[model samples]
Target chain A: MRPLPPTQRPNWRYIAAEMVPRWCPASARDMHYAILGCEASLFGDSNAASMRTSVISCDGGVVIVRCIRGTEDDVETALATVTDVGVAPVALHPFVTSGTIHGLKKKIVIRSLPSDEGNYKIGDNTYRILRMSGQKVDLVQQGIKQTTALYLNTDDLEDF
Target chain B: MRQFPADTNYSFLPQGRFVMKTADACIYPYPVGDASLRRLADELELRGFTGAIAVGIPAGCTVGNVRFLSGVDITANSVKSCRDALRSAPKTDVVMVHAGDAVFNRAILGNIPLHILRGIYHTDKRAFDHVSARMAADRGVAVDIDLSRIISESGSRRQRTLERYREISRLSRKYGFMLTISSGGRSLVGLRSVRAFVLLGAVAGLDELQVCEALAAPAALMSPHLSVEVIE
Candidate 1:
């Protein structure tokens, strides 16, 4: 074997310090020094564990968080505060017949899953999907003209 | 139609030893092969509830070994249909009808052998009124007060519901008709204790005593032999 150079020599003293006997009762001074060494290693040190950024996607106002291998409850709790404004968690009830979607002149069957730009049903007969900024849908019902809209939670929609 | 238990006593017990003899007026029956009924029975037993009137029980389905004695709920859109249906139905301990149209409500009030009148404030137009209240008082038809509507709704709709409930309460007092408060809940989470119902009655402008009376009304209606004695 070739002899090592002086610059490549191992720190014997440092290695010896780390090899303290487990059976030996640790003295207060020894414990203090050990803690100081640990502090040096842990605080303001580049060798410490690095934190990875969580994968998050926000399209328009719809925030989709990707939690790899996370439980449903954990993900739900993490996104508890972040919700899409004006968009409710309602059931998407498609019309029974495709003709039902196309037949109405006053009522438009939501053709595609509404993007941020699409109109949404707010009541039994009213909608606010035409313009994204408005709160009411002006339409004629039965024979009476009405302006008030009833907003329903997405969870309450039933498929008919 | 199973015969009602002849030995069943409907007397109100003293407080702390109170057994919930009052049946929940309206409960949709569990679907065939569903364990919700069994779970509901277990939950009722745990909650010290005696029995409930199972509404909308599917045809040919048998409800056996439940903790509570069960009754059937019959719903119809018109008075003639309701009458025809009731006449055809097999004899049960209690027969509760869902109040539909104004005509149906009026027709069933005094003429029919109905145990309970449910869904008084379900529609935009009130089905129950002062005239209906008078008929209910005369015929001994107990008005069912379902708490599920109050618990499930909010905002202006909830306000409307509360107003309707208040109106019912007012009419109940003026006409001296029997009133029974029910959870009207489909699940175990919806079932509330008699004490809790009384507290809710307070919110609906009914005194605690009136609430207890309401609870006892069903039992009294079921077994005429049992006399209600209010302690307070």
Candidate 2:
């Protein structure tokens, strides 16, 4: 079989998305499936299949998604629909879209890991601080079935 | 690529305040979820929002540069109950009612105190019709298109939501009723960026300009009470 010429090949666009919470451990494969699932649900099977979306790479809390050039808008819209991967609730927000992977990479804001801020108590339950970046803090309250994620800020912490 | 830094204080500066024209009309902060109003304001700033209406929080305060307006949501099952709820609803910047049946919607749209009609996605298919749409337009009551349901729901549920939103979008185009966009976020992670809302709005058949106008509608809703001053 012979490879097609560059002009004959399908043009692709890359999108850079950052997973919320900064602690979601979903890998590139997980992100790929999540995007596919969201696209399928939002655009239906035929439209989603025609989009030809895939995960190019995952670094830290960011994932680079590649899709057929003209379908960038559809892909970005689908990415907004993805609320979770596996059982962990998360949000994948696309920050930039570009024709070249190099250009997309340059536009990706470098994500940093959330550091331990401190512990806080509200009423009867006690929560442990999971991730703190700037004014926002992510707290985890252990429940019977799953952990409850509490998103708060420094001012709220001070009130406690 | 326009993501703001985590600590970016969108407008809460002592020297100068950058008031954002765009605001999320509705979000439930703390008690509903662990995210406090201040945290939600900060998250909105990081996501490019300059102001928001917190359902349970006190109105008229600026947190981290993002203007915070108080709002009250009435979850009633009937028109009479909705009217009663409105009568008792605490004084806030915005008052919204969850959509019910067609009769309920028509009755509530004409209410002078109602500022917004929300939660149309889960209502009956005929809940909001041409009559209600016309009434809303005439009354200047905005219809809220919540993106949180579109973002969180899937399968048949998501399809139904999109269908409802499409119907509302079509009606708004024809009737020229005001439309408001909200995340209906319960936590910080649930908040979305303006671009995200615009893209999600497209999924519901809203154009870019429509989405931008919807985002800015909340600010306009609050300006009607401003005192007039002579510019001369």
Candidate 3:
């Protein structure tokens, strides 16, 4: 059964944003798109509440994110890597080197490889490492794209 | 057709200063000349809003006068005022008009200046005789789809919605009036906050123009005070 609906539901972000000044440091509003994050009150440390939001859309270059519903503390662990915030945070391509793994911090590194920025896209799902958690990643290590076909061609239409 | 991007399903943005609409998108108790509407219009302008449309019989009003994108929600008192709003709205501003609930009498639908239909009102059936009288007037004028109140109430569902839209569009074309799809907010997420709605609209055969129009146009036209900027 659905829960009873609230009588007055002013857009939560607007309420949170409008109410922030009473308890916040930043007064300048994100007034254009008018998208407001609750973390507006707790600025500076991004990894705090601001770093974690739900994914809306992401291609190689462009990405769009949205508000997430969660408690105060569980925001980080509940989502992807802590590095997973921000617009185009990291290229999505997979590369290999081998570092170490403290359970989920699986890492692999390399000394040198081809240096190309445009070749790497945000949604490419690839990673590379050499030293991880005091352990050395092992490989004759091959780059991720060399063995997989996960890359997508999205050049025609624009949904940005 | 544009398809969903590969990494489209996921990828959260880092906590960078982001931009959002100036204020909450609200459906006011309009045509009442209340302070909130004036304040809303001013607030909208200060923040750069550029588009909106008045519901019911848009007769004398200008381009962004309307709110409550039909099927969003309406009250008994609000409905009558809305009909008055419709008749007095401007030609361009009167993008679309509603027939209220199909079951009601003439008083509810009133003498809406635009299109006529078997539009559904509140959940009650065998109801207000006056509203029925308003709707029952013009016959063979324009083909308005009489939907089951159960479904037409919040026509937000896509699979079922697209069909209703096609009918509305067809009728609009035949009558030489523009088609405006009412938000059947089954689960109405804030239009400003969600990107999923943009993606969904893209996939649902809405062209880029429509998607962008939905994003800012309604708010802009209805409330003139909102400032708007175009990104190239």
Candidate 4:
């Protein structure tokens, strides 16, 4: 493959930008392609060439990779063999957006019940607005002796 | 000497300090924010942990290069409830049971499917015995040895923990059941580096290769597709 021009040589940031658009909505198989593409672009052809035989695919978000003479064992070794190019697996979200509710520290209601210990509750009362972090929320409910923290997705909390 | 912490936030980990370590992954067993999984994956890649696994990930969350495995911790004593939880855990890649009464441990080991019994440890009572180890080995259940318990406790508790590990190690050798050593930390500070985990394993009477094998046990449990080559 021809190398990009000096001005256009894809850096990590550039590769990441290319990946962000397809990341969230892409299927697990597509996500594997994104990861491979980013790694190949940022780390250059040599590293990518070595990983050529390690075919990475996914089933239900679980990664399944195989080397040339692949078996279950080869997959593990292949995974360990990959050089850590310091590539972040997921895209970083910008703190600001064009919306009324900001990201973290914003108050949101517990639209859904939490599945873990992070949920805060009072006597017979489960619905309340809690302060949000990235995935965690500071829950302080009346009648509950101690405050608790909860995770967002599992809790199914909605923004108020 | 890779260590899988039972719970941790990759976002809170000290980038510089953690990145330099030899450990490749830290299993976060809690629900990480949808956006944070990606961000943390990016941060981990930047820090040289090209392979990090996050458990208990919620649905609709997109995973990048990082491995995302779902799991749930079963603390219930009722055999029916535990079995029900295991049966319903189709999305979970691993199932960790908090070992309590010996009867409950036997019930879990004998009846649960081999793939589903990923981890069984965490108890003051002597939950694992000769019979339990044999059952686990036959069924492919891994016995988890959480280093955080040894680090946090003191005096008699620490000694008991060490003794329990030694016994488990012996059983592991005799029966050939998989042993997984984890930090089981809730925070970055609680998480130990690979060197520390190896040393802790040594103190628990496990040799270096055994410790390494213990570290790799989780990888096998996470996916049926992963299997480490046996070195002669």
Candidate 5:
């Protein structure tokens, strides 16, 4: 089949979203299906089909969701409804929207945190620092399923 | 344009008018979750919120660019008990009550000095009817739309919540009652960005401006003495 002309092709919009608990092991496929499921559930199959939502990339805790130009808001609404992918509970927090994949990628700043994990204590209970970005610090209780994560900042750790 | 008294909490634009501050009306920190007050404030600032109402915390605390308001949630079996709870509760930034039966809602809307009526999704279908919505509008009490349930719940429960919210949005438009949007977040992970709330509002059939106004409602309610100037 011959490629459709530019005028015939649907205009696309890319939305950049950060997954909460950035360390969660959710793959691109998981995110794609989760987004599609959410869109279908919220807008029904017809509207979801019209939107043409897809997860183009999920790299380093950030996922770029691609959708038709006019349906970016609907896609965002669906993203907000996606509380989990499979059994892992996570949130897709969208920060920016752009017309091109290159433009979306340019706006996303992927910080490189210290590779080595650190330890911290709070009221006799010890927690290992899972990921530190800016003032936000993700912590995991010393012994648990690792599913339970603590979201705290540097100031909160001052007393301990 | 509306009028607001000059205060340090409000930023004064070059036009000599107050800039409506976006605030997340409800958040649970510390004992309720691992997130501390400072951490919550930091998260709010990052999410583009100028202020937030932290349930059970005192008002007048500022961290970074975000300010904290004390919010008290009253849950009672009857109107009399509700009144007693209100009287005993100290002066706070925002007063929110859990929605009750139809009669209870009407009674609270008229008699109480409440800022927000919350948890409507959990109540009976007839809890907040047209009469209650009118009372809320006349009394200047905002109806709280908690998005946390919509985010976390699924299947029938989530559908019910969405239906309830859609009805509330319709009522708000018809009766002119204010709507306040809250993340109802217990931790940083549960909190949402401003744009996210606006999109969620769209899902409930609300326009972007309505959601922005709702985000600004808590701040205006906190300053009862000043008139709220909602930006277009």
Candidate 6:
């Protein structure tokens, strides 16, 4: 391969950030994850506790989240609230389909996936990820769709 | 681990370890673009995932053509560059590389490490497509690809999906790659799926933690993480 011309030499900063860490955090990295989005929030239901609907500007998209963990009611009602409501009536989430077995009691079987993308921190040492899961079920009327739910796996929202 | 009782909400893994097949992470190229990556990450987060999606693209192509979905914190957009980086890294450091490509006119199989392949997926689409296709054509590389979890989440007819998998499996196996049963939750994988292929059982479905009695003693013989005491 030929050497890059001075003009064509690409910036190392983009590549450095892309491949490996070039900068260290001011403090030790603590692994923590956030619960984002709910079916309820998708439909413009705003009063879902401490969770707020916001978007990260670096990458643009609106998400349902809590700047800090909220109340249990906040978590309960708001978790997985951003579901697709207009389309169907009784579809189960994907986790349910993936792990749970349905019966009279709506029983589910969930296996912990070793790594959840929701759980990560660049310069931190902690390991946390939102407990995102899915279950599959067919509605007698509407059809099949994935129902999603979220939870705080860390102490940040454990009280909630 | 114990067998999961049907009604229990928390199911036990076949053994209590995450299955380590890199293929378990193989994803189709369409969803890895900028905006989509972030949404995908959020969706994965809401669903409780920690690993990065192995976004495969065709190789030797411009970076922009690959539509990178935005949700991920750090995308590994360089399978091509990792090799150059690795040649100069420390001896113990892992370099990203795929197993096999370039055989006779007929495609063959090669041993690209799973983690390396996973990293490459984040690069450009053409690079990924070329890599997978070349593996199919030259080295018989098989892509156990899938639509993004979002697409899987998006509603679709079961029959249509089943047909799609069947076709994809046929294509992969035709050129010398095996197709694994993924996407659908808890599928009924039977002896029937492995009919004519030159492959074996689903690597993803196996109990990852289960080991033969023989290799067990040796790892225990080693120090640190690999070391485990034998129990009667």
lDDT of 3 at B167: 40
Candidate 5, after superposition: displacement of residue B180 in Å? 0.9
Residue-pair clashes per candidate: 9, 3, 79, 8, 0, 69
- Superposition TM-score, candidate 2 onto the true structure: 0.89
lDDT of 2 by residue, B1-232 (tens): 6755556553443423335478898888988866887777777876888988788875567876688877999999877788788788778879988988998888777754688899999998898989999888777789999999999988888889989999999999999888999999887667888888999999888998889889888877765443456998
| Local distance difference test, each candidate | 0.47, 0.82, 0.27, 0.46, 0.80, 0.24
lDDT, residue B152, model 1: 48
Local lDDT at A114 for model 2: 79
Clashing pairs in 1: A89-A154, A89-A155, A90-A154, A90-A155, A91-A154, A119-A129, A120-A129, A122-A150, B51-B68
Which 10 successive residues of model 4 chain B have the least lDDT summed? B14-23
TM-score of each: 0.48, 0.89, 0.27, 0.47, 0.86, 0.27
Candidate 4 CAPRI grade? incorrect
- Residue B122 miss distance in model 5 (angstroms): 2.3
B112-153 per-residue lDDT for model 3 (tens digits): 433323242322333323324333322212222221121222
Question: Please, what are the lDDT tens digits per residue for candidate 5 over residues B5-62?
Answer: 1122222122222333898888988768667776676667667788787887755566
Instruction: Give the runs in model 2 whose Cα sits over 4 Å from its true position.
Output: A1-5, A117-119, A142-144, B6-20, B224-232
Candidate 2's displacement at residue B91, Å, is: 1.4
Give me the displacement of residue A153 in model 4, in angstroms. 18
DockQ for the candidate 2 complex?
Answer: 0.66
For candidate 5, the per-residue lDDT at B86 reads 86
Ranking by lDDT: 2, 5, 1, 4, 3, 6
Candidate topping TM-score: 2
Tell me the chain A TM-score of model 5: 0.85
- Model 3 docking tier (incorrect/acceptable/medium/high): incorrect
What TM-score does model 4 achieve against the real structure?
A: 0.47
Fnat per candidate, as a fraction, reads 0.00, 0.81, 0.00, 0.00, 0.60, 0.00
Can you list the residue pairs that collide in candidate 2?
A: A95-B1, B11-B65, B12-B65
Worst 10 residues of 2 chain B by lDDT: B9-18
Interface RMSD of 2: 2.1
Report each candidate's C-alpha RMSD, comma-separated, in the order given. Answer: 25.0, 3.8, 22.4, 18.6, 6.5, 23.1
